[model samples]
Target: MLNEEKILAILRLQKCKAVGDILAKKLIVHVGDVVQIFREKTSHLSKINGIGKHVLKHLFTKENITLAQQELRYIQDNAISYSYFLEDKYPQNLQHCVDSPILLFEDGAIDFSNKKIISIVGTRNMSSYGRDFCTKLITDLAPHNPIIVSGFAYGVDICAHKVAVQNNLQTIAVLAHGFEQIYPKVHKKYMQQVNENGGFLTEFWHNEMPLRENFLKRNRIVAGISNATIIIESAEKGGSLVTADIANSYDKDVFAVPGRTTDLYSKGCNNLIKNNSAFLLNSAKEIVNMLNWDLKATPKIIQKQLFLDLNENEQKIHDFLHDKGKQILDVISLECNIPMYKLASILLQMELKGVSKPLPGKMFELI
Candidate 1:
């Protein structure tokens, strides 16, 4: 646990306009401690990478310190809980992301001991197909006792949370705003149930509003906190796709449920699958299989291939990936001497043939 001074210092840094999570971390590492950052001379601090006069101008402002003090009082009075990025209790998966928040506010009984967390996200204007798929997917995965995470907005987010609650599975609502107010107010009704099931998490302060950018910022947490992200449904463009892209960036597996060619919502999922950004999800089994989740009582399904065939390029890529483990597309191309444009199609073919799987961060590994 952080002491009062350190916590206050963190709050102050968080309030600084020039500092983001990445820069904050750099500052802390450079200064040797959170408190030292505030105590250190501006001249010495500026010497560190990414720290400059512009950032220091806002960093030591009286206004930021005053605001931090006020927020600290509120946290103390209300017993608001938080986790610092350096703490052991911080989300493990999120810790891997370069831009994850330096601090997180949380409520209820959120636990990450299970390790089987999966985020399900999609359009706020959730279609019936999306709803049905979200419900069934959680229900089927319930036996494995995975935590379901979503944005807690309407449509797919709330639906996933509700279904997870019904299935007695832990569900996390990663909020875009502060705990002081809930967006869409209608979701307030389900707050208690969600708390009982899992909990709410946010990086925003107590009074922060649910601004448009916060939702986009919150997507990284939803994507990073999970082992894999499932896009139940999406439009031609949506926040869920953003989450999928972020998850891909984090090297996490992404799954997209397919819909008809003409369906507006399925277009996003179809595009993700077609471009090999996401695996074509048919059922819970695909997730279970890809993530290598073990069932408590079910017999394991195994498909043995007696003969595996690969052409010259596929064989070279496969051999390289198999020997070296996960490799990004560019590195693979360089090592295999394949042109990038043509390599993409080769990798997609490999993915379809069950020879390899695409990971976030443009990486591939043999399956």
Candidate 2:
């Protein structure tokens, strides 16, 4: 059974936006005694080093307690499960975050601990090129079977999720709002599809809206969950840059596909490349080489045989990956002339067959 009191404790702590580890340390006198503070409402919190009467008042106030209970019950009733920061099932990658969410709600069957993960983020008012790049990039990376992570907003975010699901790749959308309701009603179909394909994740409980600030708060998860972030397109100022900045802060690699100099959408990306904030990538092959990964030589295998198992579109990917050696998703899509949406599924089958591998920097390598 879930620890109800502990759950309430987490909800209480989340109100302050304090780091989970910091809160945990300050709430308990010692490591062994940590669970006690969460298990019961006691004066122990008041005795903890940094905690004050003011903080405690907010935590134990009648209104706050009522709200916490309501949120917890909604989660429990919906069968939405969450793992506390120290719980075994919590995302290990996010565990190191200074402001890591104390409790994360998940609604999907996919495991976050799966092999490789990458996040793709960009502006909401994306250009045609941005949309195209998102499709193709994910398609090429899909074969490596990395879990795709994003914020699930409009533009590149929704595009990423669509491609990921089409490729049969597991995708996780970390939302800023509570799980009680999805923010954009337009994404209802996509959200339902993702539940069966990957899952929806959030730190909020129920009935939360996607407020402007909430989206910003959610950027941490997008950066924290993935090994790297691929910025397909952005403007001078937008949410895409926010994710990129967060990714850099987390010490994760950021890659951008350069666009025309005059294109406003490309300005942010080109600036990133110019300022050395990101690597200028044109192919997954370059990304693979940067990561220094080489699939060890094996018996000469029949390439056409692998192609035979794939659909016409999938076959194109097999040929493309084989010819390109290893490349970024954007370049491959251009070279092969494949649509991003159609390419995702092809990559999925290849990943399952060990024909390709997704790398840390949003690149894929052919086996």
How accurate locally, in lDDT, is each candidate?
0.88, 0.73
TM-score of each: 0.81, 0.74
Report the C-alpha lDDT of model 1 over 1-367, residue by residue, as the tens digit: 7899999999999999899987887677555578999889999988887888899999989999899999999999999889987666888778657688989999999989998999999988889988998888999999889999999988988999999999999999999999998998988999999999889999999999999999999999999999999998888898999999999988899999999999988999999999999999988988998887864557856465556788999989977876666765545665687765688899889889989998765667888
Model 2: residues with Cα > 4 Å off, grouped in runs = 16-35, 38-50, 291-367
Which ranges in model 1 have alpha carbons more than 4 Å from their true place?
295-367
> What does the lDDT read for residue 238 in candidate 2?
85
Candidate 1 pairs with clashing backbones: 248-360, 248-361
Clashes of each: 2, 8
Tens digit of per-residue lDDT, candidate 2, span 1-367: 4588867756765654333444553353232333465455556556555667666656556665677788778877887788876555777667545456667888887697674778888878889988887787778776567788888888888999999999999999888898767767788878778988889888876787788988887998888877788888888888888888888886688898899999988888998899998989787665555543335447977545533456676667777777646654543454566644455666767789877776543456776
Give the candidate number with the greatest lDDT. Answer: 1
